[model samples]
Target: MTKPSIVFLHGSGTNADIFRLQTRKLAALLQPHFTLLYPDAPYPSGPGPGVLPFFEGCDPFATWMDDSSAAAEDAYWSLEDDDSGAARLLESVERLVREEGGGGELVGVVGFSMGAKVGMEVVRRLEGREDAGGGGVKVVVCVCGTVPYRGGGDVAREEGGRRMLGRGVVRVQSVHLMGETDPWRAEGEKLVGYFGEEGRKVMWFKGGHHMPAEDAVNKQVARIMLAACGKV
Candidate 1:
């Protein structure tokens, strides 16, 4: 049987390199069962002095929008709705799936921090689009992130509520890995709870905003993601 493909979207301000370690291990362990693809984010590096090219930025290192600071909030909101860059990325995924002869394969997504946010957005977008292939992103593994605009006030709730409702009564399995003391924990749980009690998994670790680089945590995360995808 042909293996299902896994697409890795790096966090904001970071590139595909973030997934290199996880992908290598997962490919070895899940050999012949999964193929991995790590794509670069769409935005160009923002202007700044002393920037280490790709090595400088905030936590999870992301720039999902043109002007990171100016339109950060707006970018987050528009990410799932309809953005040219995001659309291009999704198109690339579709092409890859078809090219690999796995148009309806059991695909999974692993996203860290900002990438996790984007992954959730992608899932939300896929929920309604009939043209989307690859079996509806079977499982999603989100590390150190929460639903967009969940607690920003009434506007946030209304925006999130719409997407949640548009998800349309379908339960998608999700694994949320958060730091035990990570400030985002409460919000993360709220995001999970919004799923309405179906195939939602949560794990808390002793770390910060970034995913721990420990071998054990990486392995465990991969396992959780694969299991959610029905690969284990």
Candidate 2:
């Protein structure tokens, strides 16, 4: 049988490599069932202080947006609903999918923090479109994520983002893993709610704003990934 492909998206001021490190064990667990692709964010480097807390020692990270300051309150999430940059980001994902997925389309996506916002936004963009069928992402996993806005038509990257009602309902099944002490816990809760009461799950683990490193936690996360790929 052909293996499925899943994209791993990283948080702000961090490249795809960081997420790989964070989920190394889980990736190993799911390797047999799915081909995991970690696409590096295209934008160059971002503000020094904007880096994710877990990546404090990492150098010269990349970000999905052009936020001048990485302040938790100031940093905005979501693909600008009507911006060309959003299209570029999607194109980048598709390009990498074409190259790494071996002519196969992405089956699902797992994102962290800012990347989670991207995962959720991509689902919104593809909703009701022709791409919603098979070979498209059917599941999304957001780890310690924030909410995205949709009402405003043309949004700038630098705009202050307020959590508004999402533009369209997300038809994909989703899993949200939030940290007990994570600062942006509410945002994750709200995002899961936006997905509606069905086809979604929300869980809180012991920790703060970072992927759970415990072996048991990783195993559970792997099961989620496997289930997403219809391997379970």
TM-scores, one per candidate: 0.71, 0.79
lDDT against true structure, model 2: 0.70
lDDT of 2 by residue, 1-232 (tens): 5566888998877777677888787788878877789987766775322355656776567777654334322333434444455556776777887788776667788888878877766666666454555236778888988765422332531233433343445668888899999888887776676565577878778988888777887787778767766777
Decoy 2 TM-score against native? 0.79
Ten residues in sequence with the least summed lDDT for candidate 1: 47-56
Per-residue error (Å), model 2, residue 44: 3.1
Give the worst 10-residue stretch by lDDT in candidate 2: 150-159
Q: Go through the candidates in order and give each one's C-alpha lDDT.
A: 0.61, 0.70
Native-to-model Cα distance after best TM-score fit, residue 95 in candidate 2, in Å: 1.1
Model 1 lDDT, residue 229, Cα: 68
Compute the lDDT for candidate 1.
0.61
Candidate 2 residues lying further than 4 Å off, grouped into runs, are: 46-58, 67-83, 131-135, 149-166
Q: Count the backbone clashes (under 3 Å) in each candidate.
A: 6, 0
